[model samples]
Target: MLLKSIHHSLDELICLLDQVSDHDYTKSCEALSNATIGEHTRYILEMFKCLENGYDSGILNYDYREGNNQIQTETEFAKQCIVEIKMGLKSENKTLYLEKVINGLGIRIQSSYYRELLYNLENGMHHQALIKIAILQFENMAVNEI
Candidate 1:
């Protein structure tokens, strides 16, 4: 049930991306201090990828992620990443170790794959709300509410 909701959120994000022009997608918004919609999208996708990596390796570190510029500006690349994420989510459940840096200290907490997936979904939605605002303000585009 959680996976289904995450997939649906991802689909909604993709649909929103499809509606925006590439120029607008990459355009920096003053409200966000010149952060583009693509950047937010990349952030959201990378979080999912991080969760997947954690599930595979038993250690999830969200602080360190591959900084792929293409994932930010290229819509198709982001779409591909989404597909990979969906596939990963459908895999067998496992224990996940969530690593977080709090007050300059590293902490590890045991978590379940499904719980982490829920985190990713909620995280994506938070970013999606920002993206929606940017889209509405910067470009005359219709964005679906998440």
Candidate 2:
């Protein structure tokens, strides 16, 4: 069920991409602090990539993302990354570890692969909402409804 939700979110992202022109995709919105929709989409994809890498290595670090610029500027590249992320999520579940700072103290905690996937799903949706707003502001089109 969680995987299905992630897939659906990614599909919605792709649908939004399909509806926008390349110029619009790269257009930065002043209301959004000059952040382009492509940049938001790229950040979402990289977060999933970080989870996938963390799932394999047992350590999930959001700071270690590759931050591929191609994924930001090219819709096809972003779509490919989404496909790769879905393929990675199909692997067997495993225990993952993450570090967090609590009151300025760093601590490591055990986590599950599925839970990280859920985090990525939610994170992706949050960015998607931002992207939807940028789309509305710049293109005057609604996305992710159908």
Candidate 3:
């Protein structure tokens, strides 16, 4: 059920992307505080990437997840990333550790794959909402379809 929601969110993102041109995808939106749609998309994708990267290692640290600039600057590459992420989404739910650094201190917490996946899904949705706002700012694009 969680995976299904995640996939649906991803599909909605793809639909939103389809309506956006490369120029607009990378263009800064005033409504988004000058952040590009691609930037948000990269952020959303990277959360899942972080989870997937740490799934086997049992150590998830979002801060250390490598950022892929290409995914943010290139619409096609970003779409391909979504495809790859969807393909790699399956895994048996198991204990996982989430690591984060705050105020110069590192913190680790016990978590599970499903729990992290839910977090990613929620995070993606939050970004998607921001993306929707960004989409609305464009006069040329039909934002209602998304």
Compare the candidates by TM-score and give the number of the best one. Answer: 3
- Model 3, TM vs. native: 0.93
Q: Candidate 2 — which residues are off by over 4 angstroms?
A: 100-106, 139-142
Clashing pairs in 2: none
TM-score of each: 0.90, 0.88, 0.93
RMSD of 1: 1.7
- Please identify model 3 stretches exceeding 4 Å from their true place: 143-146
Question: What is the C-alpha lDDT profile of model 1 across 9-111, one tens digit per residue?
Answer: 9998888877777777799988888899999999999988888777768898988888789889988888888888888784567887888999999899998
Q: Which window of ten consecutive residues has the lowest lDDT sum in model 2? A: 137-146
Task: Tell me, by lDDT, which candidate is best.
Answer: 3
Candidate 2 lDDT, 1-146, residue by residue in tens:
88888889998888888778778889998878999999999999998888877766798878778989888888877888888887877556788898766798877889988888888888888888888778877545667552
lDDT of each: 0.84, 0.83, 0.88
Error of 2 at 19 (Å): 1.8
> What is candidate 3's lDDT per residue for 1-146, written digit by digit as tens?
89888888898888788888888889998878899999999999999999999999999999876688998988888989899999999658999999988899989999999999999998898888888888887777655343
lDDT of 3: 0.88
Q: Which ten residues in a row have the lowest lDDT in candidate 1?
A: 137-146
